[model samples]
Target: MEEKFDLLPLLEYIPPSSLDYLEWVSVGMALKHEGYDFHDWDVWSQADSRYNAHEMESKWASLGHNGGQPVTGAFITMKAKENGWLSRQYEGDGMETFGWDDEISYERDYRFVDKAWVEGKEIQEPGDNWNPVEQLQTYIQTLFSNDDHIGYVVDSWQREDGKYSVRGSGVYTKTAEEILNDLEKYKDQKDLGWAVGDSKKEAGAWIRFNPLDGKGVKNENVTDFKFALVESDNMSLEKQNAIMRELELPIAALVYSGGKSVHAIVKVEAANYAEYQKRVEYLYKICNKNGLQVDSQNKNPSRLSRMPGVIRGEHKQFLIDTNIGKSSWEEWHEWIEDLNDDLPEFESLAGMFEEDPQLAPVLIDNVLRRGHKMLIAGPSKAGKSFALMEMSISIAEGLPWFGFNCERGKVLYINMELDRPSAYKRFKDIYQGMGIKPANIQNIHVWNMRGHSIPMDKLTPKLIRRAQKEKFDAVIIDPIYKVLTGSENDAEQMAKFTNNFDKVAAELGTSVIYCHHHSKGAQGGKSSMDRSSGSGVFARDPDAILDLIELEVTDSLRDMQGKRATANFYAEKIRDENPSYLNEIGQDDFLSAAEMRKHLAAALGDDRAWQISGFELGEVQKRVKLQTAWRLEGTLREFPKFEPVNLWFNYPLHVHDEVGVLKDLDYVGTDKPYNQRKAAVKSRDSAEKKAERKKKTTDELISAFSILDEGDGVVRIGKLESYFEKSRNTIKNWLKNQDVLMIDEEGFVSMRLELD
Candidate 1:
């Protein structure tokens, strides 16, 4: 008869106590439906404290199929899944096979080896120069520390089939130190049996890979939970060695079993028994997936492995290698996962040389490309956030952003630094200020993550999943510091953090645009790429970087702007009341206050013009004073370099300088060398000192005359000396060159009058 189906292995994952009565009954019914015998169910049920020995067998027999549909093995599989049992398939000679209904889906591929590409490595036995005592001592020292209790079985009994098997659980009371000492003491005799115990030559020996507590030989008695055994007898020995090396399993010791299999003690380094079980399961799953057929029965912590330096009938079970793979379990696991990442495969450049490969479409005309990244960096209150919001609107409405045309498509604005209401109002304000209608308002999506923002590493996947179906052309993140994951100055950490943006852009097929702040200093002298406040990776990683630097608006420019604004205010008032008056005024006349007043008199009559002349025009002057000038420099990867664009931040919007008003303005420090800047500052200070001294002398003389004058508009020189803090002669000489004052030899001072 065919072997009874084994449900016991899967039952290890599903504890009976975790199940309710109905779920428990379902398990038994499914077991019966799958043709498993009653004994299997009874044995597994006994693990729960509620199990009644007498009722279990009767309950199992009564789980026969009724008139309704019978529960199949899928129920058992589902319960296993709920309890962390992954559904995996193994393909090799003599490995357990899954039925047609097994739901096989691996969350990630852990396979690091290919069977067809494996180059088998042959194992060579030691010649007449072999030392059994040294081999045994090395194996023991590599696996255990001095304080760890060692378990090894040497004695065995012959089975009825003439094959030898281990007789007992072996000795668990000896420490590794004692075993090594004994081996060294008996080295001169060359007798391995005297150090531990004599073993049957036919069975070789067995030793537990993990250290025990010196009190028992069960899984619970294991202390360190360190190593696990990986052995396979169904495949060629040479192939197993090659696959094990290819997978880079962290092996503490590797021993040939004198038979078809090789025993590899793999370092799991789990903290507890529970963690040990999980790690071993993961190790086995990875091994099986990679074409190394590991024996599933060797998973227990107390399971015995082949003891090296021992004889088994006509062959020797000898140590092959130690510390042969990765240094630690964590390092090895990371290497495997990185090797199997879901990155795209490589293609030969020669294959596409004959034809031009298509590039990602342009998202921001002449600045950035679709499915790429762009960074906008500037100082605080430079309207960086406003610029990003305007870009979003521009993309949605098919308009221009900072003089660059944008492709019209769906866009997502992730607001990480604003409250929900403020964010909504800002979008509306931008729309009104830009004078763009809401023709494609539906294309603009606002995800107000404000208070709920998380790190970029954790948020990127969620962003991808949500925006995958939106078919967006761009994703704009305002102020990246809210979700930045690591120190901005650390290149390694920032690289990992910024890679999340790449993931989002690649997964969603959208351009990712974000804003950052400039480094704390004058940004005039630094390159555009070096001005962002972070590691240089931030400057180099993106496809395009746009930097904003403040420009020094000269006093003359401000005065010019005030006059032009005042004239425009008058022109607008006349245009509103008398439309024909604009035709009478020339274009240059609108830029002059006198010309605008003459036009206003003709347009609205003298009474209205007089009323308009008295108007304060304070609001217009305030608008001019509040205006901030900036120069935008670009470092683009996909396009040719363009001239720097100048802008004016006029409250709610950044308006491009169309008439080159800001073209002559320079950044705060200019681009001069440090020494040159210092010299210019010194020269400016010297000139200012001369003008200030002349003004001070004139004020003192005028004040002294006013205080000493007795309605005659003249003051005595002796009284002026008290204010001058100098001699009378010095006071007289100081007034000799004054154009506004006349001093006589009699020591009296009077005002100087013009001859005209």
Candidate 2:
């Protein structure tokens, strides 16, 4: 089918019965024109053998594709694992993919010509003076005599698999001469020859191919050469040579990381097995530096490959956006097309993420990372500040407060409304329950009021400088309105600040969490872009956006019966999640049951945190956020093995999986909030009751504290216990007399004392 000198045709010229199997040389050269798959060797002896359709077409397609200087008496075989190519590798021998050292080594030429021959299906060509392998052997043998580093096989023997087993030791042993004598010994007995040379080295070729082109006469049975791989826009001579130089094999394409140019592909001529291993290691390194996971890569034929490409400096001829970062395969394809139209100056986007060590967690692992430009726009009384105050504390501490773990990071509360100390006190109460000192919360930086604000992006970096200069890992912005520089929805204005924000956060390698309120009438805890009060720019460039909604939050189970249950919904906006518009039934407002085509667009793009709250379906959404919303109920004690993501994702107020949801308590109506506690084991026996009593006393001593107003007559332990309806022993265990108890001159119970 093809006009080229296809080995398939040559195959027909030989009788299969004469040879048990086909050898490597023919397969190697034929693959150059034919597809790599070539023929099914198992079916080679079939009488009805017909060529593969694709291979037939490709061979004909490349009428003029042939390049490289031909070898005269050439022979091809697998680099016989035993005594062959690998064992020949040595250090300083430098088994690089591609290398162009000066001059042709003449002694290397004769050895290859002296042994080995070409064997096809049934055709076998004995010794020829121009054998490339013999030349290679001669070059190697001569090198051993001249250079201490170059070595030849110390010993080799033929294995039944048609290969030579070789053994060599030490680091860089030069054995060019040993190889030549060994070839001589086999010369008469086997009628096979072996040698090596680089048609790639121009000066070497000058002494070998053509003197006019700086090549000399060829003595080996070498035929036209083959390039290992090719990867370039063009197949010009210069390009081919560049490929040969970078990679020892003349590969056509260089699918490196940047994919910008071919200067990346390289070649290594392994002098020994050790050098060969080093080459493979180098290939893996290139992949790693390019952000490619070796385990994730699934290329079978890939002996090695370079990164996409390197960014030399400011490249205009070929352009990339520095800000755009690494593009996916499809994304890169689209970007390149766009470049053709506009010719934007390309910036090196690779290695940008590596600039920050802290950000490495998000980049290296497939875990999610987000940036937020939240707009808390709800009406004043909608508990906007309350929601923010709560969420901000959560991010500052790795543990969740109510029922959610927000990709916890540093927090900066920029609250213009609340008094600083009041904010501190509220945080203090939460911290008291948390059992950690609030003073040691380094990541939580509060910019107490509006005037202290700078651009949102500057928040993370400046705080990071403060944290590291001071020691913190995260930054938080509270009540988003205080720190915003411009109108919320203005794209230009919002973009300027958020871009700066993301840039600085990325640069400093810190995760910034912002707390903002939802707009009035916004449906849920999370509001879409349309509902976000400002420019709605937050929806565009975030790693993740989390929306928190609270229905009427009741402190007690009795209070939740008639109110809209607090509802929280978080949508992962990055990647391709279908429009939240429709569910299984293709309906948008499953409740309003509206057939809207789309869910509300987000306030920010990418995956960033967005808080949305307010819903009557606290019961339904809790199931949904668990099965649907944040998705898990119960407590850490319940799913002890689950990850942080599973525990407390939907923090509906009072839905403390740590304790239980608000519905479990009577904080608002049922009795007193103090009565709420984990279900305790019941003990009916006297001993168990006594143990329980002791435990209760211990609890009182550890946790209970009394409060009083203008109390001078604090009372003695017995009286204090009697007034509170607690046992005297329980009161005494808790140090009741120190605050509530009073001692008189006669050491009698006194009622006057102060609560310390």
Candidate 2 contains a number of clashing pairs equal to: 179
Instruction: State in Å the error of residue 347, model 2.
Output: 9.3
lDDT of 2 by residue, 1-756 (tens): 734322343333222221222232243344443443434322343432233444544543442245754321112111111112221224573332211111111111101111112121121122223333343343333212332222122233445444333333211222335435655665544322222221111111111110011121121211211111122322232342332232223222223222233222222233433553455344433322222212212111121222111121232111111111222223432432353352347666676555754533431022234432333333334344555656565665555544445555665565666777777776666566455665437666666754566655545444444444322234455655665777776789877766655654553455554545545553432323333455566655544444433333333432332222221132222113444422333222332311211232333332322222224234444543332112211111112332222122232232333423433322212232222221222223666877776666544433322433125433344544555688865555455424433345443343443458
Best candidate according to TM-score: 1
lDDT (C-alpha) at residue 307 in model 1: 88
* lDDT (tens digit, per residue) of candidate 1 on 364-424: 8999999999999999999998998898999899899899998888899999999999999
TM-score of each model, paired residue for residue = 0.60, 0.27
What's the C-alpha lDDT at position 369 in model 1? 91
